[model samples]
Target: MTNEPTIRSIIEQELERRGYSLSSFASRSGINRGTLSAILNGNPPKPIAIRQLDLMTEALEQPEGHFYPLYVNECVDSDQPNRRRVKAFLLRCAEVGQTECIQEVLDRIVENLSYIPMIFEIGEELYEKGLREESRLFYNVVIESEKYQHSERLAISHYRLFRLSLGDDAEANLIAATRFELYLYRLPEDYQLDGLLHLANAYLTLQKWVQTEIYSDELRNLAKMVYKNYERAYLQGKAFQFRAERNLVVYYGQGYVLKGIALQFQRRYEEIPEYIAGYADLSWFVGLNESGKEEVEKFKLFAKLNTYNLKVLLGDQSIIPEYIESVKKHPPEILPSLRVIVEASNIHNFFIDDILEQFNIDTGLYDRADNYYRLEVSKDRYLRLFYHLSVYYLRKKEFEEGISKILITLKIAISLKNYNYFMKLIPLFERYRSFATEGQLKEYETLLEGVIKDA
Candidate 1:
């Protein structure tokens, strides 16, 4: 006999036939009323809490496993050994760029492992093979595993990999943010600059800008404490770079403009030219006319005619074409200090366009209808490109594509735990949920719930 009704639909219809409201059923079944409502409304249930499912089945007067079968398919013996064999096959397929084979392996693993992190090693290997989708699935499984039992290091590693491969997603970002917060709480007295850097970056991505600033300030203070040690002092500069990038992204003109002034105050006068130049370049890119130009020029004067001793002192290539033009036009003898500045300036200017282009995303702002993608070489550029592309497709009603790209971008932001991007994309997800598949829609809902909970 052909089965006329699907299991889920039949369950809902049966409950209604028995004259049971969701609230009444939930009360009887010991399930949360809201959860029952979500399930009845066709939202995907979280993996059934077995004890709760048992309660549900008992209340319905159904045999155990009647509502949901314990086993949906038969196990087949593969020619190879156990789950490891399956993992290896998936890894090999991923290595060879056989995405379908990788997916097939994922399906088998999911069926077998019930979404556990036992497959994480294979997932990490697949990530190395450029199978980002498969890798993310595996990482997701790990992240959702029993909290106390899960490997924190493995989770962090997978998240870093996810960020490297897929950019960021809401899930990974939230996971990273939580981990960072926990690490800070657990290591509140730890003076490790590295941990502080991670926390700062996480906070920055989460748009906890004040927290980021606090962590960054703490890191700098720690760096200062150990500055007598050359190696420790170098670590401070590294932390500065870390914070500087986030500052650049958020505050734009003001951040870069002030950074130039700060470098001068630190008595790192030789290194000031490039900061000045970078500020100028960003100002021009963002249509901030004549903003940092005066400060940049002031640095340029000291940069000229300061050759030989300068290289040994600064060791950076900051003062290239921009400084060179200032020197050559003014007919000053280029000093060694100035040459290093010139070189650094050239390198900085070379990357300014690539950097600024990241924020110049097309969000269907110029035109409301057409959809197109502009490819820029820098990874940083990809964020804005995907952001705009998703918006473009979304505005044109090409939702699947829009959602796909948005998810991809979200994955990147999550990997980075970038709060700014996360906030930016949540609305997009809501706007496009109508066009997403039921499964995709559920994922969006779960993501939204997670964001809200975290906030």
Candidate 2:
């Protein structure tokens, strides 16, 4: 009958085979002779640390992580798992790229279900240490095993997953954002401010106007409530634990800015100014720390820019000159600003040849759209900009220019798998089909064929 191998048995046999004395092996393993003796000979056996086990494994001349499988016996097959030893071993397993061992230990740890909190705590520590992939394992364990539907730990795990999962694909990010939005309110007060702001912006980037409105309102109300409490705390010489990464006013102001933007997108023009008014005069807002004051100033500038853009959207062409000048002053605002101007020009049937020409150099740099803002958000804006430019040119009977821009838009939309834009522009291309040049017409056919195949 074969006896199952354990760490102690394996180490003892390895020592015997190597003809090493206990003191010599202790020196080789960098462990003290007394501790090594007690570990090998104590009646119940002294607990071994992950670091010590690694040292012993090296002394045994086995591979790194050679002792992990055997150590799981030490971690769990004993009377009960010692929290510190299990936690340290799990963390070490993550650090050393022993995913299989991590899986083994986690599988055993979760059997009792009480290890979820420790798992989440380790996930947070790993995340903070920049071991994101390692952190995801524990975070996912917490998410799946946490029994309470509304536990703060579950909410935070969801939040961290959402954050870690975000990347260049907006459609993929939309899925992550949707999953996270359900837990927005369950976060701590400080985290709620951040969560709501991010959720609102995520929906805004994806052009989900209704979700944008929902979370922006939540952020606005929450920011205002917290602002009041913060002021009262300061006045009464009490302390408040509420904190967010940004100066509080930035969240407060973005809540209003994003709310107005969502309204503007839905043609809820009359409603926008009311929300815009919410942030326009934040100079009177209570908190005026240096950073807070700077954010409020940015809000005031946005107030002017959005107010001007709003007038143009309402077909009040008189605001064009002042609005164009305002946008020119803010260099980074040029791309999105031009998108609005092009849409308004199409809507109001007004001219913007000089305005477009003025910013032609800036618009040509759409490949670096992420330089101005977050990558996905900036790319989405540029996508819309091209679509608007195409429509504006077509509606104005600038057929050649229109076809060129429309084809460009189609290329971008298809590469992005933006079926909504592809469908919209195909109809416009059909409407203007008679006017296309031979080359433009051929490219259009190829693009259409590609789309049909993709569909």
RMSD of each: 21.4, 4.4
In terms of lDDT, which candidate is strongest? 2
lDDT of 2 at 213: 92
CA-lDDT, candidates in order: 0.48, 0.84
In terms of lDDT, the poorest run of 10 residues in model 2 is 361-370
User: Could you tell me every candidate's TM-score relative to the true structure?
Assistant: 0.32, 0.79
Instruction: Give one digit per residue, the lDDT tens place, for model 1 in 1-455.
Output: 75556445666777888998888898888888887766556445433343555577788898754643221111113433255444544454454455554445455555544435556766766656667766765665555553543345343444444354322343464565565454343332222444555555444434455665566666655544433343344445543223222222123322332333334323466665554444333322221225335434433443333332233234433433344455444422222223234233333332223322333233422121221211111222345456655665566567897798788777655544566777889887887677898877776676667767866
The candidate scoring highest on TM-score is 2
- Give me the overall lDDT of model 2: 0.84
Per-residue lDDT of candidate 2, residues 1-455 (tens digit) = 65898789889999999999999998899999999988999987788888889999888888888889888878876446899988998888888888888888888778677888899999998988889988989888898899999999999999889888765556677889989988887999888998898888888877789999999999999998988998898789897786576888888889999999998889989888888888887887664789888778778888988888888888988878888788777766777778888888888788888888876543454555335466666666777898998888877788999899999888877776666677798898999999999999999999889867966
